[model samples]
Target chain A: MNARAIDVRGLNKSFGDRHVVRDVSIAVDTGRITGFLGPNGSGKTTTLRLLCGLLTPDSGEGTVLGMDFRARGDAIKRQTGYMTQKFSLYEDMTLEENLAFVARVHGLDNRRERVEDTLHRLGLFDRRQQLAGALSGGWKQRLALAAATLHQPRLLLLDEPTAGVDPKARREFWDEIHTLAAEGLTVLVSTHYMDEAERCHDIGYILYGRLIARGTADAIIRDSGLVTFLGEGPGIDRAAHLLARADGVLSASAFGAAVHVSGLKREALEAALVPWRKEPFRWSEVPPSLEDVFIQLMGRERDERYTS
Target chain B: MTGSLPRILAVLLKEFTQLRRDRITYAMILVMPVMQLLIFGYAINMDPRHLPAAVLSHDTSTVADSVVAALERTGYVDVRYLPRSDEELDQLIRRGQVMLGITIPPDFTRRLLKGERPQILAEADASDPQAAAGALAAVSVLPTEALRHERLGLGAPRSTAPAFEVVVHRRYNPESRSPFHIVPGLLGIILSMTLVMMTAMAVTRERERGTMETLLSTPATPAEIMVGKLTPYVVVGLVQTVVVLGMARVLFSVPMARTPAGWLALACGIVLFIVGNLSLGYLISTLARSQLQAMQMSMFYMLPSIFLSGFAFPFLGLPPWARVLGEIIPVTHFLRIVRGALLKDQVLADMGNDLLALGLFVLAVAGAALGRSRTTLD
Candidate 1:
């Protein structure tokens, strides 16, 4: 079997004068979970939509699930499941009815039996009679998951599926995602949460409609060429705030009693931290964190924007 | 008393902001009454005149000529067609091409000279009796007044009833029952109002609920989804139709399916009407981004259909320009089909042109709806 579930190149989309997704090329291996990490309006959702058949690109070409994505969008849509940012299931319908509606829409065989099995598997059998709108945020997220995955799509795309969900529910949702990935479903989920990105096998960071970073978490942090210095002292909070505004500093924020300052250049970072180094404040060089790398990338992108 | 000025000003400002935000509602509030006034004032004529009348005269005598001439002078009848035979005149009236048809007997002048009253026939297209009422009532005095000078002194009776009497025959509705005109027309208006509004709201509600993205992402084609969305409403329309028709039959005493052919035509017309309106509403939904806009558009369509489609007034009462506008609306043609089939026992062959017009409307809307059901979110 082919390893790549989604392999697209040079995909672009624009609505009116606003160019949303530009030159987005991505390839997801089979059975792997790829997390798209970006801030809101960073082309994560639009790029995800382009990967699935929900949106046609202004100019793009590739195969999705081994079929020509544009020429065979209907065929692609049949095998793929896309969960939108909002809870989009029929609110007036019960859990079972929503699942049944999904089944009926896709023309799945043994619709009733499939719906029943899905309900039972999700532990939603008891409350299947409850309307989707009445469900709490966590339950609504879970129901959206069930509805998206009901057809056993080979590829899944979820755009910020767990935004407002609780921590416990998010863990369960990730666990479900991993289980589905293990079963050979290529899943690409978009979210801003650092933990969610860490949970994925690989991550892609998008900024200004372009994929800026793509790798495992450790690789992304290492490739960012970011350096950090962890300072521990009584007056470090005041020192950290001063350090953040100093030259060559990417970001510096208090993490507790201690403060961490990050920068792209080691010399500039050391020089910036030199002021508070002697007076009851001890500073040690540390490996840059994932959050530090993202901060560095955002600052660099802003610089690139002004320079261009 | 000091704070009241500020409070009232605050409310006025808030109202202006809301009114600006909801432009469609603003337009509806301001535009509806002005349009109603214009339609009622200028377009609507309670007593329709210059009605198209066909004259089928078998008499070649001067008396028949004067009678036909007199009917024209009343200003209610415009003698547009002179048919060769009585059957041709009946055909003209039956097709609703003319409001009335005058048929003079072959021995009309000879019988009147022999002091015998000859019955002159005037057939009225009574589907909309109000249009032909004045013309028929005035036909009784037409002959005596028309022959007043040419009476040959004592030869003719000119004081009261004419020697050659006009025997008015109301073809479709003999007693000119107003219910027959009104009850059948209600079907089209009710179906258009409900079916169009409901379907428009259904699609807009889906978008509002954010379910449209999920629906479009599925394998279900827009055509299939459209069918799924509109299928349930078909049943609703049918039930409503049944309720309205049943009540019309019981309460208003409107006749139901006078012929087997009428039953078939009515059933077919009703089905087409419901689907056509549903498709139109769906088209509106595709254009409307919000539920409020969809509702406003439906009201925009419904109000015009009620006023301008000749449901409230006579179809021929409006000017030629207005009739041209009415021809475009689906309700106008559907009303014709309903009244033509139910009251006049007109078969499909009789209203083929109307059925074709309505069928074309159905196809156009359905095609446009399907086309507007975009697979891509763009």
Candidate 2:
């Protein structure tokens, strides 16, 4: 083993009576991109915070970069760069000034040279003197990233870093992340976009404070045991509604012009679609996508927790 | 702690840079006290001058002229108008045109000639009680001095009877220069209000913006960050104290009873107290959610300090309950210490209780602030 960059296990965090993160365990290999995906209140941000020592877990034991997560949090924090969900930089300060402040805060030597290089590398050298508040969302994201990585931290924890960014800027940002990963920096990124998760080396899916699955995207899709059938023609939304309540149908969601119906039982899914065949609809069986598998997984987990 | 020194220096440099960018805050921090010193030095006067008086002279003769001369010579009263009737005098008093009304009896000169003790009826407008008392004192002295001359025959007036005596004593501030009293108290008020408010807002703004957590996650500990943030404000506060004291001396002629070194020592103690209070404000800011809430909390604490701290009013004049409330304010004790040392020339031994009170206040507030900062989650 090449020494995991982040090795946290059995992490538990609770905000009063509600458990935010429950007995979560995960590890990221050195220089690998790990995707954290979950619903809105699924503890992804909390887990990311715990991994970077920004928050102290209520209970559990772990190590980040060979430092004890509980005992040597300061050391872990010093070696990690965290980009918050919001655009958090001094709005009154110019782009160059904000970067310089971060550099000075970390006590980086040769501050002027380092700030100059970081600005040039991020393609923000031309807009260096513009105030941070005036920058577009894409430019602000670049500035935040530059500030975060200025200290050359060993790990990067990005919490929904591309929430408001455009597609082109997001693609460029991912390219930058991959470039940094190539230089031996581990990245733990939480994202809602499925394409972004597919780009990661491995994925962890969390639901309601619990880690439901962890594997490659293809592996998770296959392991879900979801069999999906596409029904395309008129009245797909109405058909999707009928299919959602049908026996043995786990979930039915509209994917573009077609309704994708998925279930864990292959024979039962086909039997349920027999009534739909009476209408003028083109039915075709297809390999279940990552989205279909996750929908079916969410359906099964929701029933398991709620019914019990 | 090998790299701690450099880190501290780095933090200090960063703070100064930020402060430089906040130009409005910097101007308020540096210029307000000096401007206040100039305004209050000239505006506040305890020994009021140019008070208007109405004379109802039934005996409109040379004796009345002589009485007006004596009143003018005292330099406390300005005889504005001579009313013909007592009704007119009453109208003048009611209209606030005159602060005092003097009625010279028709037999005023004849009474002195007959060797009878004549009393001039002097009615004063007591609406503004302090000015009223001063005006009455000025008018009464005029006849008694004239009577003494009449009995002794010093300047050609001869009399058979002696005159009643009048004595006056100015208390608290004998010279009655506003700066002498106000400047010393201002030292306490300015230091406490500005230092506590500024530092509290700065800390709370960072926390609201989520920058405190980012700053804390660095190698800096809570103590290191606090000390770094506090160092510049202490310097700034001391500079302001010196500026205010220097302006008081130049503009108001407020005497500096102690030596420069003594003033410097007092300034250091006051700066320490201010920093401690500011730390307490920081703790309050941490508990508050936003800057507006932090400001409201600061004002809530500040109102009692201003009213009960004996800066604007005399502490001894307050009731017993108010006195107890005054004792609870650190600024109240600090004002006494600074004023006693600078104005009254009292030594440290004479101000032992005040010094102890200030020390206890600083220690208690600082201990609570640091404890809260460590325990609270940002």
Best by TM-score: 1
Write down the TM-score of every candidate.
Answer: 0.96, 0.74
Please write out the lDDT profile of model 2 over residues A23-81, one tens digit for every residue.
89988889999999988999998888777766778888878887788898877777889
The per-prediction CA RMSD against the true structure, in angstroms, equals 2.1, 15.2
* Candidate with maximal DockQ: 1
lDDT score of residue B201 within candidate 1: 82
Estimate, for each residue in B1-378, the C-alpha lDDT of model 2 and write its tens digit.
Answer: 987999999999999998797664565455556544633454334565667777778874556666777777777678889899988886676444576777788877666665565667777654334555677678667645654554455343464334422232232344555567678778777877788777777667887786665565556666777777777888878887888888888988766756765565465457656776777676776666667666656666676576666566545334456668778788888767676556545455555676677777777877776666641242
Scored on chain A only, each candidate's TM-score is: 0.97, 0.96
Model 2 misplaced stretches (Cα beyond 4 Å): A278-280, B1-172, B347-349, B374-378
Candidate 1 per-residue C-alpha lDDT over B52-103 given as tens digits, one digit per residue, 9 for 90 to 100 = 8888878886665676678778888788898998778777777788888888
- Which predicted model would earn the best lDDT? 1
True contacts kept of 1: 0.91
Residue pairs with colliding backbones in model 2 are: none
